[model samples]
Target: MSIDQDLSHVQSLLDPSEVIPPTSPLYGPNAQGWAVQKDLHPRLVAVPTSPESLARLIAHLYKSHLHFGIRGQGFLSASAKDVLVSMTAFDEFHFDPHAEVATVGAGQTWGAVYRKLKEAAPSYAIVGARTPAISVGGTVVTGGLSWLSAEYGCISDPENMLDAQVVKSDGSVVWASTEPDLLWTMRGGGGGFGVATKFLFRVRPYPQAIWAGPILLPRQQLPTVATRLEAFLASNPDPRVSMFLYIIRKNLLETIGAFQDMLVVHAYDANGEEHGREAFKWALDIPGAVDQTGVTDMEGVTKLQQNVDKSKGTMRQYWAPLFLKTLSAATITRAIELVDELAKQDSAVSDCTYLIFELFALCDAKGSCAWPRPPGAKHVILIGAGCPANASAGQEEMARNLAEDASERILGSRTVNLLANGGEEFHDPVMIWGENLDRLRQLKKVYDPNGRFQGPIRA
Candidate 1:
C-alpha cells in the first residue's frame, strides 16, 4: 500500500483530532525531550483517545509492516524515524481508596495523578521523583526509583502493582495482570514489551510534612564531610532518609580559577518535623561553608530536592549506574578523586559532570516485582557526566574519556538503565535487554509473526 493509503487506514481507525500526518506542525517540528541534544521527529504521529481506537491503530500498523515509537510526555531519549504513538490523549483516572490503588491512563502526568489522589486520600503515597511533569507510565516501566525508593522500594515492586491494560504487538488488547508471568515482566520491562494503555499502582499512607533541601559545603571540607556521611550511614541506616552528594564546579569560578567551587550535599527525609530535625543535625556536624535546609509538604519537598534547572538546555548527558555491595570509605575516597580529576580537566560543559550516590537497602528481594537488580546488591551509586550539546568535538571526546575512567575506578555491577556509551565491553545484551527482550521476541513471534512492527530500536 502507498504511504497515503496507510495514513488513511490509520485515520479511519482513530479520531480526526488524534491523528497527525507527516505535514502536521508537530510531525517534523523541533520537539524538545528530556535530553536536550536529541531531536524528536517521526514519520507520523498518532494519538488515540480510546482503547478500541488504539487497538485498531496497532492492528493497522502491524498489517502495514510499520513499527511505531511510543511516547509519554516526550521525556527520555529519542530514537528512530518511525511513526510516533503518543499516549497523551488517554488521560483517564480512577482511584479505589479501599484497595489503596489508583488506575490511571498512560498519558497522564504524575502531577495530575498526585493531585487527584491527594483529594481522594489526604495521605496517599505514590512513587515518583521531584519532577511533577514526568508521566507515571514512563517512570514505572523504567523501574521507577525515587526519594522513597530506599524505604518502600522501587515503584515496580509487585506488591504495589495490581494490573495493566496493554495492546500486544499483534493488536490484541489484554488486561496483562491476569497472567502472572506477563504481569511480572511488564511491571518493569519498559515499553519494549508492549504499549501499556493504563496502569494500576498501589498507594500508601504518608505524613503531611517532609524535610528536604540542599547543604552547600566548601571543596576543602570533602574529607570531613565524607567521613561524617560514612559514619552516619554506618550508625543509622534508615531507609526513610535519602541523600545525594554532588561534586560540582563553582559556576562563577569557572571563568576565574583552575578549579570550580567545592561540593554540595542534598538530603531528604519523608518523616515529619522531628525526623527531619535529627537528619539535619548530621549536616550541621559536617564542616561546610553554607547550609540551606527547609521543611515542607511532599509536593514542595520534591520540587526543592530534585530540581535540576542548571542542567537544562541542549546537553548530551551520559549516565553510569553502579550497585556497590557497600559504599566503603575506600570507595567514597575513590569517587571523590574521580570527581576532582574531572573538574581539573574542565571536562563537564556546564555543572553537568557530577556523581550521584544513592544509598538503599534492598535486602527483601522477593518482596518487590521481578525488576532486574544486582544479585546480593545492597547500595546503588549512579555516577553521571553531563556535557553541553554544542561542545567541541575535542571536549566531547574528553567527556567520554572521563566517564570511562570513572566507571573503571568504581568496581561494582552496572545497571542497564544508565548504560549510554556504545563501547563493546559495556554492551552486554543480557544486561541492556534484560528479560524483556526475550519476552518481547516471544510475543512478537506469536502476535506479529510477519515482523511488521520493526522500528529503529528493534526489541
Candidate 2:
C-alpha cells in the first residue's frame, strides 16, 4: 500500500484529534525534536491517549506491515515516513513514597518528574535525566545517565527499573517483568521490543540539601585542570562527588560577538554543603576561577544544569560520545587543539559547538543492564556541534564529521544512550550490544519475531 493509504487507514481507526496530518501546523512541531530530526517527514502522526488506543494502533500497523517509528521527546533519531506514533498523550505521574518508586508516564519530562517528586516525596530522588526537558521513556530505555548515577547507577539498571509497562507488537499490554526476557531487554537493551507506556523506577533517599554548580577558568588553564582532574579521578574520591570538565566559547552562554574560550569545572556533591565543600576543595582552590557553586535542592540543581545544557532546538545538532576508562593528559591536550582548530575556521559551527567530558564514579554495587560500566571505564566524553537549520547538506555533513572525527581521535567505545540510532554512522552492532548481543537477538526473536520494531541492534 502507498504511504497515503497507510496513513488514511490508520487515521480512520483513531479519534479525530489524535490524527495529525502533514498539512496541520502542529505537524512541524510534533514531527521534530532537535533540528536534525526535522526532515524525517513522517506522513502523519498518531497520538494515542491510552494504552488501549496505543495497543490498537500498534496492532494495526504491525499486522498491515506498515513502517512506523515511536517518538517520545524526540531527542533520539526516528523515521516514520508512514506513521509517527507520538506518546505525548500518555502523560501521567504518580509517586508511591512507601514503595519508593515513581510511576512516570512515557511522555512525561524529567523536569516535571523532579518538581513533582520534590513536593510529593521531599527526601527522595529518582535516578532521572540530568536535563529537565528530556523525556523519561527515551532516557531510561536508552541507558539513562544522571548526576545521581554515581550512587544509584543508570536509571534503567535492573535494580532501579522495578518494572516497565509495555505494549507488545501484537497489541498486548502487560508488565515487562511478566516476561522475564522482555524485562531484561527493556532494562537498557536500547528499545526495539515494544512501546513502553509506563515505568516504575526505584527512588533513592536524598538529603534535602546538596552542593553543585560550575567553576569557569581561563582557557589556558586546560593543562592544569586536566592534570588535577586526572589525579582527582585516580585518588578514588567519594562516589557522591562527580565532576564534568569542558571547554566552551566564553560567550557561548552569555553575550554575543568576539568569542573567547574558557574551561568549565562543574562539580556535584550529593552529600550536603559541608562535606561537599571539603570534597571539592581542590577545584574550589583553583585561582582566577569564576565560581557559581552553591548549596541547593535536587530540583534546583537539575534546573541549573538544564539552564546551560538545554538547547533551543533551532539549530541542527550532532553528537559523538566516547566511553573511556580514564582521562589522559594527551587526550585533554588533543581536545583543546581541536577546539582551537574549529575556532580558526571562523564558521557557524565554532560559535555554537563545545566538548564535554563527564566523570562518572560508578557505585561499588553492580547492576544488570545492557551497558554496565566496564571494569575500568570512568569517563563518557561527548563532542557536540551545531549548525544553522537552513545550512546545505555539506554544512550538515561537516558538523557530523567534526563530531565523529573528534570522538574517534579521543579513543573510547560507543554508548547506546548517545549513539545507537541504527543509522549510516556507528553501524557496528557488536559495539552497541557488546557481550549481550547474542542474548538480545534471541529475546528479539521471541518477543518480536517479525521485527515489527526498528531497533539499532538488529543484524
Candidate 3:
C-alpha cells in the first residue's frame, strides 16, 4: 500500500485528536531536541493519552504496515520517515512516598518529575545529567549517566528500577520487570525493545544542601592541571566531586587564534554543606589558572547544567565516550595534546569542544545493578561538540572527523558508545560492533519483532 493510504488507515483506527497528519503544524515543528537529524516530517503523528490508546495505536499501525518512532519531549538524535509518536499528551506523575518510588509517564520531563516528586515526597532519583529539561524516558533507556552516577549508579541500574509498562511489538501492553532478562536489557539498552509508557524508579532522600559551579582556567596550564587532576582522582576518588574540562576557540576577532583562556571546569557536590565546602576547596587547590565554585540546591544545579536556550534554532551536537581502566598521567597528557590540536581547527567547531571525565566505582549496592562494565574499566571520558543546526554541513563532518581521530590518538584501546555516530563502524579490535549489534538485534526481534519502535537512526 502507498504511504499515505497506510497513514490514513492507521488514523482511522484512532481518535481524531490522537492522530496528526503531515500538514499539521506539530508534524515537523522546530521545537524538537538538539539534533538536526530528528527534524524529518513523518507521514503521520500519534499522541496517545493512555496505555490502552497506545496499545491500540501500535496494533493498528502494525496492521497497516507502517513503522513508528516514539518521542518524549522531542529529545532524540534519530530521524523518522514513517509515523512519529509524541508522548507529550501522556504526561502523568505519581509518587509513592512510603515506597520511595516515583512512577512517571513517558511524556514527563525531568523538571516536571522533580517538582512533582519534591512536592509529593521528600526526594527522588537523580534525574538526567543536571538538566531538568531533558525527557525522563529518553535518558533512562539510554543508560542515563549523571553527576550522581559516581555516587549511586546509572539511572537504569535494576536495584533502583522497580518496573516499566511497555507496549511490545505484538500490540500487547506488558509489565516487563516480571522477566529478568527483559528487565536487564531495558535498563542500559536504548529504546529498541518497546515504547515504555511508565517508569518505576527508587528515589533517594533529598539532599539538605548542594555545592556546584564552574571553574575557568588558562589553556596553557592544562598540562599541569591534568597531572594534578589525575593524582586527585587516584588519591581521593570522591563520588561527591564531578568535573568537566573544556578547550575552546572562537572565530570572533578578539578571541581568534587565542587559546590561553578557554578551559572551564564544572564540579558538583551532593553531600551536605560541610563536605561540599571541603570538596570545593580541594578542587580549587588543583593548581589551575582560575577557579569558581559555590553551593546551591538541586533546582539551581540542574538549571545551570542543562541550560539550552529554546530560542536558538535546532542544535547539532555529537557525544562520544571512552572507558579507561585507569587515568594515568601519560594518558592525561596525550588527551590534552589531542584536544589542543583539534581546538586549532574552525572556530565554530572548536568553540564547542567539551571534555568530561566521570569516575564510577562500585558503591554500596553496586552489584545489584545491570550497567555493563568491562573487567577493569573504572573511568568514562566523554568528548562532545555542539553547533547550530544551520552551520555548514562541511563543518559538521569536520567536527565529527576530528572527534574520532582525537579519540583514537589519545586512547588506543577503549570502548565507546556505538550509537553515538549512528552506530558508525569503528576500527579498534576491542570495539566490536558486530557482537553488540547482533545481541541488540536479537533482543529487538524478541521484544519488537515488527520494529515498531525507532531509535539510534538504524533500527
Task: Compare the candidates by lDDT and give the number of the best one.
Answer: 2
Error of 1 at 173 (Å): 1.8
Computed on alpha carbons, the lDDT of every model, listed in order, comes to 0.63, 0.75, 0.63
Model 3: lowest-lDDT 10 consecutive positions: 417-426
lDDT of 2 by residue, 154-239 (tens): 77877777889999989999998888888778766778889999998888787767788888787777778878877777887777
Candidate 2 ranges with C-alpha deviation above 4 Å: 35-38, 253-259, 307-312, 412-424
True-structure lDDT of candidate 1? 0.63
Candidate 2 global lDDT: 0.75
Sort by TM-score, best first: 2, 3, 1
Candidate 1, residues 1-459: lDDT per residue as tens digits?
776677667778777888777677765432344555455456668888888888888777766745466777755554335567777877787888888888888787776776777777777777664466767767766666666767655566676557888887667888886756556655554445567788888788886677777777777777777777787777755677877776656665454342546666776777866786687676666654455677766677656633453343457655556555556666777787777776667745535665777665343344535345655454656665667777777776665655555556665434433321122233344553455457645654554466554321233
Error of 3 at 288 (Å): 7.4
Report residue 376 deviation for candidate 2 (angstroms): 3.1
Lowest summed lDDT window (length 10), candidate 2 = 415-424
**84 Cα displacement, candidate 1 (Å):** 1.1
Clash count (model 3, backbone only): 0
Please list the residue runs of candidate 1 whose C-alpha ends up more than 4 Å from where it truly belongs after superposition. Answer: 21-31, 36-40, 252-262, 305-313, 346-350, 361-363, 375-378, 400-406, 412-426, 432-459
The backbone clash count of each candidate, in order, is: 3, 0, 0
